[model samples]
Target: MLTNNIIFYSDESSIKISVNKDLFNKMYQYCDKSYPNETGGILIGTYLDKQTAEIVAVIGPSEDSKTWKTRFNRGAKGINKLLKEYWEQGIYYLGEWHFHPNGSPYPSNIDTDTLTSISNNSKYSCPEPILIIISGSHNCYNQKSYLYSSTGQKFEMNC
Candidate 1:
């Protein structure tokens, strides 16, 4: 079979997420404490994989929101500013991270639909589109990180 050579960028698969540990800790903590209500944000960085948005850092919503939808919309707005920063630094917004309170850290119905919309909205959205879900099991730290494509297909990061 003659197939085009598939060369995924290396040297980054082993790179531990450079996102501020404190930030991840906070997200993880929030999810753990807010079981059932999902908490989520975006990860920005210069990563090789499209879906696995290397997690250069984690951003959360201000502590006043009383609804998931509110926080989610706030996060979307906040990410626009962050995206500008990433562009200036030649970095990219890889993927999103959210918590699945008391549930598996995988894309739920809303998540799949949301990411599907993201895919349609941008050209940068491509292969390995990552959507990380930190379950109530132990926040984002202990919770598993699942990767999903723009088409709502799930996969695993090289890590």
Candidate 2:
């Protein structure tokens, strides 16, 4: 049921990221299902080169995830297993995606901090990670994509 793909790139034109339309729709569904509460999950995909990457899958929030009207705390339950399975198939963690529930499609301070931590965390093994934030109601949504460097610098990508 997925069709088309959304692509984004950094202003310096050094990074290109793509996501399947279906996966976006799926994210919207998760947001809608969560209603006034916030929700999010991890992005799974592969990098084509040093500057281009494609997101192939989206994992919904785990059962242990906590949501609030203005904040979300993604849980880690079962994520390691999922990532391992995808790794065996040549895919891996690309980044994170979250819903803002009628808020702006921008990274909040906490969001930025989280991405910084992920980028610096030796466990994730990703020096640069992407963060996608979707904002709005059920069918009417807006999104912003950012790539975070290990130093915590955020680069907003144009869609």
Candidate 3:
């Protein structure tokens, strides 16, 4: 079933995230295909307000990336082109999504580091970036989403 916009809050920040049933199904399928290895991609969506974002699409991993049972390195290949195309269509780069094979859907140290880098990097342009972690076996999957603000605060959102 499709989820309505869900609001999650931290002491310093809050955000709203939503995923349609179709998009969820597609992400699940992609995660399943990468079973026993980690996979990830960028999240495309629009901001509803200063603190809220609506996730409309989840792009799959780049073909140049490396995936292993414990790690996933998202390569920078064709992403700029895709981002340009999406920007032309009025969709902005909201955040990222990744799967953790046989693990919990919580952010790891590396995940937090990556999010921090994204928030601090001038190239990203987004002051607050979302991170969605999908974890489970091939038969089932779960998600844990977080929002990281430029101030270095991270909030775990309900999914």
Model 3's alpha-carbon lDDT is 0.81
Q: On a 0 to 100 scale, what is the lDDT of residue 151 in model 1?
A: 63
Output the better candidate (1/3) by lDDT.
3
How many angstroms is residue 69 displaced in model 2 relative to the true structure, after the best TM-score fit?
0.3
The digit string of per-residue lDDT tens for model 2 on 28-132 reads 999999989999999989987877899999999999999999999999999999999999999989899999998999999999999999999887878789999
- How many clashing pairs in candidate 1? 4
User: Model 2, stretches more than 4 Å misplaced?
Assistant: 1-3
Q: Residues 1-159, candidate 1, lDDT per residue (tens digit)?
A: 112211222243332333445555767776766555667766566654432234555566535334452234324455566678777887776667777565665566776777766656665454444565666455234444444545666444333
Backbone clash pairs for candidate 3 read none
Clashing pairs in 2: none
Candidate 1 segments whose C-alpha is farther than 4 A from its true place: 1-23, 32-36, 48-53, 62-75, 123-127, 137-141, 157-159
Which is the better candidate, 2 or 3, if ranked by TM-score?
Answer: 2
What TM-score fits each model?
0.64, 0.96, 0.89
Candidate closer to the true structure by lDDT (higher is better), 1 or 2: 2
lDDT of 1: 0.54
The best candidate by lDDT is: 2
Cα deviation of 159 in candidate 1 (Å)?
4.7
Candidates 2 and 3 compared: the better one by lDDT is: 2
Relative to the true structure, candidate 2 reaches a TM of 0.96
Task: Note the Cα lDDT for every prediction shown.
Answer: 0.54, 0.92, 0.81
